[model samples]
Target: MIKWVAAFLGYFIFRFPGAVLGFIVGSLFDNMGGSNGGGRNVFQDLTRQSVSPADFELNLLSLCSIVIKADGQVSQRELDYVRQYFLSTYGKEKANAIFRTFNDVIKKREVSAQRICSYLVQRTRYEVRLQLLHFLFGIAQADGQVSKAEVIKLRELAGYLRVGQHDFESIMAMFIKSADNAYKILEIEKTVSDDEVKKAYRTMAKKYHPDRVVTENEAIKKGAEEKFKEVQKAYEIIQKERGIS
Candidate 1:
């Protein structure tokens, strides 16, 4: 449908050749599951590669730089946390190469969160973006606390990435401990009945399940596993609090 519409528009604006080119480009978008795909089935098949591994690392580095500098004072611990994470995820050599680029070039400039996040929104799945947010929160918490400034920047990035408010708050609650953090993690209100709470837990568990994150990268899979555990932990806390068996 998108290809046909684009072809028609192109033909109207230009000629036969324009329609051909428009259709070719539209097919690419369709295969990769464009913005309308809602971030599902991204890179599901080995033959269809939406974004390259290099591009993923670079964009991720860009986001890291944005969050690291958000609090006005760049802490070494935060920097090391980013470095160590990438190092552990991608082997030593690739991670070192990425950080080299990051230190010399990417980190020195003002990264446009809107542009980077927009690209991510189109290319990556929602589950992948959730892990990206989780990683950023880890960076913010690396220095012992998540500052107000960092939270503001993270929320802005999340909005730009088109992540829903409930999902954003759920990840945020995982790091920022509070009396009702469990409820927030479950994306439900404390006023809801036990049955509703159970339902929400089941929903979140399925949503954040490690298997839902389809990737060959062990680090990404592990991150999803950690997220799944957090959901389970939130349910446990709620169960204990409400005395639900």
Candidate 2:
């Protein structure tokens, strides 16, 4: 408990303080009753990654239900996409139980997309949230192309998550391969010179770099690596299109 408090002691102001920091501090403290050792504590402190970050798995599924339902139709493809995401992330034992929870949450009107996004944004770090957006897009694009409704809902969800405009746009660009999307992924103007395009790609390389994520969770770190690879692919596509070496 003292370690948890000391871990975030600087964040607590005279007032209650901000949401993200407050959420992390409170969640860490609250989770203490359930489960560690001094060496484990020191290890976890260095990693800044918990096995389950702020009870995120259920929240992920809840938000996913909102995403796949945007088109007013939930296909088998969409259902399976959610299943695979959970299965791959948490394995069969937990995935089966979590899917049931997802169904229950979807049936209730008590949770809104905004509320789900806000709750997650408050608790987890940015890279994890970025992956949440990534999964949402993956589900939306499962049927090949994203529908207008899904796009609007995704943008709104990103707003709620407080994802930066450029970052959100970059991710959107990656999923939309048409419409000079490579340049969009790099966040460069269509008319930008090759040098400018290279600069943008380098900037994104730094942003999505796996080591930059600073998470102890190997799973989360792998997600970051995948995202970075997406950025690399986008840059390569742009170069191919522009005939740039």
TM-scores for all candidates? 0.79, 0.74
- List candidate 2 segments past 4 Å from native: 1-54, 215-219, 243-245
Candidate 2 yields a Cα-based lDDT of 0.74
lDDT of 1 by residue, 1-245 (tens): 77888788888888998899889877877765752322222222222235566676677788888999998988999989988986776669877887898785434766889999888888766666777889899999999999999999999999998889999999999999999999999999989999999999999999989887666666777778888999999999999999999
Q: Give per-residue lDDT, candidate 2, residue 68.
A: 79
Q: What ranges in model 1 sit over 4 Å off?
A: 1-49, 105-109
Query: What lDDT, from 0 to 1, does candidate 1 have?
Result: 0.82
**All models, RMSD in angstroms:** 7.6, 8.0
